[model samples]
Target: MFQPTGQKRLTNVSVIRYKRGRKRFEIACYPSTVLSYRAGHLKDLSEVLQVDEVFENVSKGKVAASGDLRECFGTTDRAKIIRQILERGELQVSERERQYGLRNSLQEIANIIAAKTVSRATQRPIPVGLVYKALQEAHFSVQPTRSVKAQALEAIRLLQQHSELDLERARMRLRVHVPAQHDAKRLQERLVQIETDAAKKAKRGEVGSAAQVAAGASVRGGSDTSASLQMVQVESEEWLTGGALLWTLQIDPGWFRTLEQIVAEETHGSGTVEVISLRVLHEGDHLNDVL
Candidate 1:
């Protein structure tokens, strides 16, 4: 529901590199715009009818000069500037369609650079030379400090070699853990119970015994001989068996919460729903057909 004014211009761009004990600030540009007027002639009398007899055209153009760098220094020096540039550049690239009107390829490059810089900053276990090489491969310039470069390379190597571990760590940071096998097994048992109990109550006129329910018999209330004598068949089909397991897992509290969040965010609303679990044992083939 938010809209941009479309009048904002790029400003305060800068770049830098560090080497030994010194820092080097490089040229950067922040683009601005201005309106320009150009002369043209009407080719026909009809053109005059659509506008003033003397027509003027206006064109938009960039007003900022090229190659200007803003300086940053001390403990917060070249590395810091590079980090800031990478972050801001990525943000601009992501919203480029609405910001600078850049292409997808350009945005991808920006993202890669940002990711590499952040990776290097956070984990510095690799050699500087390798980090520099990796950055060059990814089309990023390296800092002058040998220490920084070594750290960057170490981070890159770890990222490249143990991507799965890196991904697991990231997921852990987000507090997303996979459910254990035992938890899944318990959920499956609960599912079977709920299903068997509901089925017995449906088919019989009296409440069936616990053992009967576990054996997949429908409960019948009272001592009506005719109803009690009727046997309810439980299905043994593969599809039904598989579906029971699936249904059980689907209704798990963690699974349900995740699904609910996904649905709510997608629909942009808050709604409520009830989930139930069940369990049942094998009797005949009635469940297969009914399921």
Candidate 2:
């Protein structure tokens, strides 16, 4: 059995362990300090380490053997070895810490929901506190694998199901004439950022959602108008050089009044607005806010 080194005990400690081949090395660090260093918030390396000694077994307070360190690391420089381990080690956190981190990420989902959506009645953004309350009432949990926006969208679904809030994404669809180059360019910029194929071409799916993969994909340039290409597709040979375009776009409703002003100003009051249907979206309302 290895003799314990009888070092001073620590509270809220986590072990960062690195393994190579069949050998292992470890360091005991204060949980909060280690993350700060890793996140580049702490510059002094010594501040993060508890004992400043590499260990063979942290639980038993057993320091690593010098011979083993030399054989594995090719040098016995303690600082170099410790730096390597910290740079490429597995941080071991307790279950309570794990759950706490998850709660923070889930709360991020609530924040996203509040930012991208509004109360249907007031047409005003829902406050973050109330959104957080709705999340708890719906029993939402952290899904580490999914994007924050996707999870927030799912939480909104649950809120609607429970009738907790009559909230709509702050978005609207419009059928309007777009000016070539200027307005059309602005409109195309907001087009569904599509997924690419092996050939690097935009893979066409149902035209409703611009962001197909929720794996950190972006939501923009607009939405779900499976209205046939004949009806919904932007019409123009080349919209860049003053060719007129009849386009259907989905965008934040807040952008509507602004768009009307731009159109009328640019067209000298000749441009007009027409409404098709302002769809109070159901499941897949694309969003752009980041967490």
Candidate 3:
């Protein structure tokens, strides 16, 4: 005969994606089922829930005997339900629903216990065994000692310490390695060599001399007067104090012709023009600033 077998309520249910391809498909299953399958190849979890509930009620004096508890589950043997519930908790509820439902059930049980019954001389709180039984029936594992606040605080502290250490280590490793002074000296020497080679090239007419190339020292007319002469060098400290100056100039065609004539007269058939100090100066100062 069918008695008042415990009613089944679906606590949680959701569709899970099983596979995806050209054709996508999903399946609906309870988290308890998945967890149980992973833990062991056990089946028939609903029976477990019924048996646990009956056993719990009987244990709490709500039921008279094992037969009565079995009758409650509409079965002669309650062992089957008990074993199922022990092996696997509630399968009817999804993870989400089970979580909320379990909490709510606990709270309700706490309230009911608080309202009823009185204590003796000491006046202690009446324990709600039924509430605990209900949770066990629902496959909710209750820990006697669980502190959410404490766990959260511990996690936060650990994360903060780790982050601080990481930042400090990074800062310590940051360093800019400057080039050696010897390297700088070598570079300067190379530059001087390049300038000397350039000067030799200028003498061979392969390149223009510094005097001919100095800026603001271009010839004005076809005349070769002292006033029209190019300043080759400046010996004043005022010009050399800041730094060396190098520059270039473009001579007028007429001035160039006159200068060539003057040089021809002075050298008198000397096939090559000999270059002395080839520096072009402007107002007792060199033309360009060298870094």
lDDT of each: 0.28, 0.63, 0.32
* Tens-place lDDT digits, model 1, residues 24-103: 32213222110000012332223212211110110111211112222222343433443343233222112333334322
> Per-residue CA lDDT of candidate 2, range 1-291, in tens?
544354434456789999977999998887767666766888776788887888887876678889999999999999999988888998887889889877887789888888777776555667888988888887888775467777887777678668568875655556677655555444443332222221123234332332221112223323333222211233222333457666555544434565566566655665565655454343334323222
lDDT of candidate 2 at residue 140, scale 0 to 100: 81
Which parts of model 1 have CA positions greater than 4 angstroms off?
A: 1-132, 138-171, 174-291
Highest-lDDT candidate: 2
Would you estimate the TM-scores of all the predictions?
Answer: 0.16, 0.54, 0.16
Error of 2 at 4 (Å): 5.4
Q: Please identify which of the two predictions, 2 or 3, would achieve the higher lDDT against the true structure.
A: 2
Instruction: Look at candidate 2 and tell me the lDDT of residue 57.
Output: 76
RMSD of each: 25.4, 10.5, 35.3
* Strongest candidate by TM-score: 2
Task: For candidate 1, give the lDDT of residue 114.
Answer: 33
Off by over 4 Å in 3: 1-12, 41-291
Question: What does candidate 1 score on TM?
Answer: 0.16
Global CA lDDT computed for model 2: 0.63
Clashes of each: 33, 4, 11
Of the pair 1 and 3, which is ahead by lDDT?
A: 3
